[model samples]
Target: MDKSLEKSLTLWLKQQQTVCAGYLKLTVLFGILTGLCLLAQAYTLASVLDGLIMQQLSLLTFYPELIALLSLTIFRALLAYAKESSGFIAGKKLRAQVRQTVLNKLISLGPSFINTKPAGTWANIVLEQIEDLHDFYAKYLPAMMLAGFIPLIILAAIVPINWLSAMILLVTAPLIPLFMVLVGMGAAEANRKNFSALQQLNGHFLDSLRGLRTLILFHRQQAEIDKIANVSNDVKQRTMSVLSLAFLSSAVLEFFAAISIAILAVYFGFSFLGHLEWGSFSLLPPTEHRLSLFSGLFVLLLAPEFYQPLKDLGTHYHAKAKAIGAAESLVTLLNIQDSSLTSHITTSLIASSKASHTKIDLKTWELEANNLKVFTHDGECLLGPISFTISGQQKLAVVGASGSGKTTLVNLLLGFLPYEGSLKIQGIEFNQLDLSHWRNNLAWLGQEPQLFHGTLMDNLRLGNQTLSTEKAWELLAKANIDDFVSQHPLGLKLSIGEQAAGISVGQAQRIALARALSRDANVFILDEPTASLDSASADAITQSLTKETTAKCLLIVTHKLSQLGAMDTILVLEKGQLNSSGSYDELMAQNGLFCQLNAQTAYDIDLQTSLGLNS
Candidate 1:
């Protein structure tokens, strides 16, 4: 990772601490209290040993000191427990807030933006990547501060007794963190590669599972399995490499701490034998030069405690690296700007609109577009600078060849794509109206029907839970699926699997249509509604849709010429531009793109009939 990027991620991680700042402070407080207790325990133990060995005191005479020592031990344990609990709470609150932030960002970007990435890649980011931040907040962050404060506290306690030992500890303290950083740089890079490999594996494995039937039909299941295996093995190797670095960091910390303590032990032994008497000083007797057992023992007892915090910091340094790797992906996703969405709507505008209870009359609603165009993120125009008009009860049909901007126009009207020119509804600019309110007044059905695992009533009432059973049945009847649903033993309660596993595609499409009708929307947009149905099913659906949408504005995109005869207007598009627009009979008489499309549709139908493929 670049140094600047790593610094930025570290800064970002620190900013999130504000959410649980109180808990983090409590954790640090408990840790400081625990360190203080350690110093008192060491002092008491050293005094008791000095009294017994030097002053020839009886062990039974020290009952109060012994009891005090035991009580301090129990109190320190409780403080340690509180510290752990506080850190855990901090981590839990931060993780929940970050996860919700990510979810809200994804929702705001909309489905068109989300569908560009694989489902498994998003799943990994939302689930596994967020989970990796737990330890950084819980352990590593608190330990970072404690590592500095606790060691200084120990040094403060020792400087009066033995300045040489204090200097020795202070000199070796920098080595542990210096080596930790050296090993951690590689560990962080390895973790980043590991996360990338895991994301790829997840996407590939899920895609294969979704298309398992197609793979089997094509006899490529074995090839897919081998590819998955190779990806999984790569992830394993990267994981092992990260662990190796983590262990090496721990080893380095321990080695430096051991060597520092050994040097202290050798100096204290020489002082006891009168070889280094200048380093030891007694405050009560200025003339005394001999080293006392109390000072030597106290410094030795506090030696391990001095290095404990640094060692713990080295151990948790890996967590910091792991969190940085995870944050790289999360920050990138949250930084994406959905330029197509109008986000500058003022709060006061929404407030005033709601206060006045503003509403538009559906019967007089009109949509007009002038020189409208759509461009990709890279500034490539995908749709035209064409013009059109739609009023209440108008039935318009958009017919064009593949990649002729049919879908792009529908997406623009649906508010999924940004436009360059004017698009107004009821004389109001489209971007000025509240998007949620505008969407509620429109109904849309795509080429593929989406149905969850539920009953007929559940699917139909998805948009309006308060819809009565009779009203649901009326919707199903309008979509011409009441008979099929009523024939099932469960009637409205009939069970279905995901994507309507127990029913045919035509039946699922009808249920989806009924669901859309339940919304009671003013405008209906259908894209290839009967594209996969047989002749009987297609005709039934077409007749029912035509009857139901007679009183509302309808925009249908289709290639079937049979459904075009009754349309009020037909738009013929050639390569992202509108070639012509007129009534069905008028376009047919023009002998242009519309006529050519009609001839091509008829020829394909005749060809299918001759090959017996239509059966």
Candidate 2:
């Protein structure tokens, strides 16, 4: 591989070693002990064979050596078991740590980072990419050290018996690694491209699945299938390339190992035939330098052992390449620094702010802003240079067309996105307060409520799980879904699909409302809550929204302009700027954006109804 990549991989491995030092030390210790056991077994077996063949000693006479061999074999087995079990634990711990690090980094990057990629791309990075590093930790890293040390131990045992064979083994060992480096360069690059292709294919397939209905309606299903197939073919080619290089590297190592072992055997054969006097350690006359059966057998036995560690090194070489490929992405992700904040306004500064020092928890919760602005990653403004104030238990509606930044306002309030300009809560800077603490006091319900696979009771208890069953039932009654839930045979224990199965979207939204009520939050922000509901459901929800915030501060973002008549204030946004702000009648009297949106609702409702009927 290139120097830069090699250095990066080395650095990353060293960092991992530091994180998992105890386990890796255990691995190396077990590995070296296993090598010692192998030597004992080999030496004992050779001694027994020599005793039988040359001295004509009885098999029964070799009992002690045989027992020693059996004992080493059992100990080796136990060592192997411990190595494997410990390696698994180490890999699990590393994977969990890496996954959590990625999750935390993603959170620090916020929703903008999430919006930049497809769900499957993130899935491939978070799940498959992290999982691919398991072997790197469990095997490749420890094997790297063992591969160098174990062979030296075997060579030390052999040099006294047959220095020539040890010399041959040492000379040939570098060729395997030299060839490996050459082969591994291509394999590393191929593996990286393969992972990228797989991620793209997954992302494309996921996007297609999410938009399947639209594609079907437009008669583009066959086209999508063909595109997916092409991406699959690309992945197949990339995978084959990686495998070919890996196989080639393994073959090269095996060939060199086989040659070294054969050379050792040949030298022992010639020495026994009196063809050479200098091959063995004894340097007397030709007859004196002759091979002793035990000496020759032991040297031959050591040949494979000398080459075995090198052979293992070849196996782990591919793992190193794979890890290097994975590390490139990991390094890039970890290096991301949020550019939105100014040079002095660090994330740590914002995070360390105390909420308890402020009067934000007062009964009269007040929010004041002065020219708040939000920007996309590319520096394009998405919201603001607009200002507003909200106080007491008031219901307010923010209305705008698509891309006008209505949702951005709520995102700012929820602390999902950062903003410029002063936003104060109870006369204290909002950014100076602990956001996680701030968020707990404010309830947010989005366009869709994420209901997991669980009992109805489990889903409903989401907002305030500490509530008693009877108390939870009361909140459900307030949400107007208690009657339907009570009539169901399974009652609170009714099983539901994750995708709002066995219940309508309206019911899911109601369950979300009930969850909000259970929390008994002082502030509630609803983002297009009834956007997906039918007219009857929508009207019912609109009516519910009016009554839902009797003693709570409610902020609503909706295109349903009719519902804003009872709202304390109606804020109109046009192209990220605040166009108007007043009650519904006041805006109508001004003949501003509110009246224009009111005029468009007639067509919107008609178009929606027609589309609904057609579908």
Candidate lDDT scores, in order, read: 0.83, 0.79
RMSD in Å for model 2: 3.6
- What C-alpha root-mean-square deviation, in Å, does candidate 1 show against the real structure? 4.0
lDDT for model 2 comes to 0.79
Q: Which residue pairs come into collision in candidate 1?
A: none
TM-score of each: 0.89, 0.89
Question: How many angstroms is residue 547 displaced in model 2 relative to the true structure, after the best TM-score fit?
Answer: 3.5
Q: What lDDT tens digits, residue by residue, belong to model 1 across residues 348-416?
A: 111112233335677768888888776542345787888899888999999999899987787666655
Q: Across residues 384-497, which tens digit of lDDT does each residue of candidate 2 receive?
A: 889998986888899989889987788777765656778888888776776666767878887767777898888777777787889878777777788888999988898888
Estimate candidate 1's alpha-carbon lDDT, on a 0 to 1 scale: 0.83
Candidate 2 backbone clash number: 0
